[model samples]
Target: TFCVLLAYGMLQQITGLRLQDSLGYSSSDAIKGTGALMTSSMALMACVQAIIFKFSVKNPARLLLIGALISVLGFYFLYVGSSFWIYLAGMAILGLGMGLMFPANLALLSLNSKEHNQARIASINNIGKGLGFAIGPLLGATLYQKTTDLPIIFAIGLAIITLILSLISMFPPRIKSVHKI
Candidate 1:
């Protein structure tokens, strides 16, 4: 998971560099600004996730779907964004989705697995992430080389994947309420 996250972070940096180069901006500009945007987005996304968790503790599927939708929109914003502020907003939105996604992914796994098997399930999830990390950079580079719009492509792909996962996560095992409302 760390590798995957690092790859994601690195991909952002690479794409930012590419964008800067293409737009005739200083190469250092994207590198310098990305960290700040990342920090701000991370904070914003954390807040968004907390709100989702507070209200939807038992509905991991719904949370995932909402996060996925927001993420998709964030990606869109990133795709067409022109200014630094626009990029920042788009990044923040993506961060919001990611914040929701991290917890929601865990929730989905937990809801799907029995308590006894949760550890194994989590391991499997981590393995999936490892695979994603291994593949994401190569894929990002390939797509970027082909499209010259790597950021947009990455954003669209993230959105599509989120939507697909959201649909899959919707069918977690139902819990029997201990006490009726």
Candidate 2:
């Protein structure tokens, strides 16, 4: 969750720069491009979340895995994108993947916790998200100053980590078998 949110924050900070610098968007127009990305993000998030709630998906990890897979593709595209339209596509795809993951992530947090510990678990999770959000933009800015590729490449790396973690989360812990005497 932390890493994923961090990548998002980084993208939020860098998207405009990428537009203006790489794709020749005017500063104001670059901001508009960011707005477009956000719009697509919110739109997909709302639609996907609605469906998730409606269906009440039981296997949150499965959803997380699928979302992570999509996210990997999205971030990869963003890294390689040389044109404005491709960047927009990458952002929209990222949004779609996150939209699918968000609800599942929340579900897992609650589902995995006991009623007694739920609040504590949730608070910890939120703290991770908060820290990620707080740091991502700063990191993004720093990386952007160094090189545009650095930000997206870092984000792509984080998204891949998220995918690997999702895979790990998918399986249940195995119970050891005992031999009876």
Each prediction's TM-score versus the true structure: 0.78, 0.93
- After the best TM-score superposition of candidate 1, give how far the Cα of residue 140 lies from its true spot, in angstroms: 1.9
List model 1 lDDT by residue over 8-104, tens digit each.
5435545566557555557677777767666767788779777876676777678778777877777676677777777778778878877877787
Give the TM-score comparing model 2 with the true structure, all chains together.
0.93
User: Clashing residue pairs in candidate 1, if any?
Assistant: none
Weakest 10 consecutive residues of candidate 2 by summed lDDT: 37-46
The list of candidate 1 runs beyond 4 A from truth reads 1-10, 49-56, 171-181
Model 1 residue 139 lDDT? 65
Question: Quick one: best lDDT, which candidate?
Answer: 2
Residue 161 of model 2, lDDT score:
91
lDDT of 1: 0.69
Candidate 2: where are CA atoms >4 Å away? 177-181
What clash pairs does model 2 have? none
Query: At residue 47, what lDDT does model 2 achieve?
Result: 85
Residue 96 in model 1: shift from native, Å? 0.6
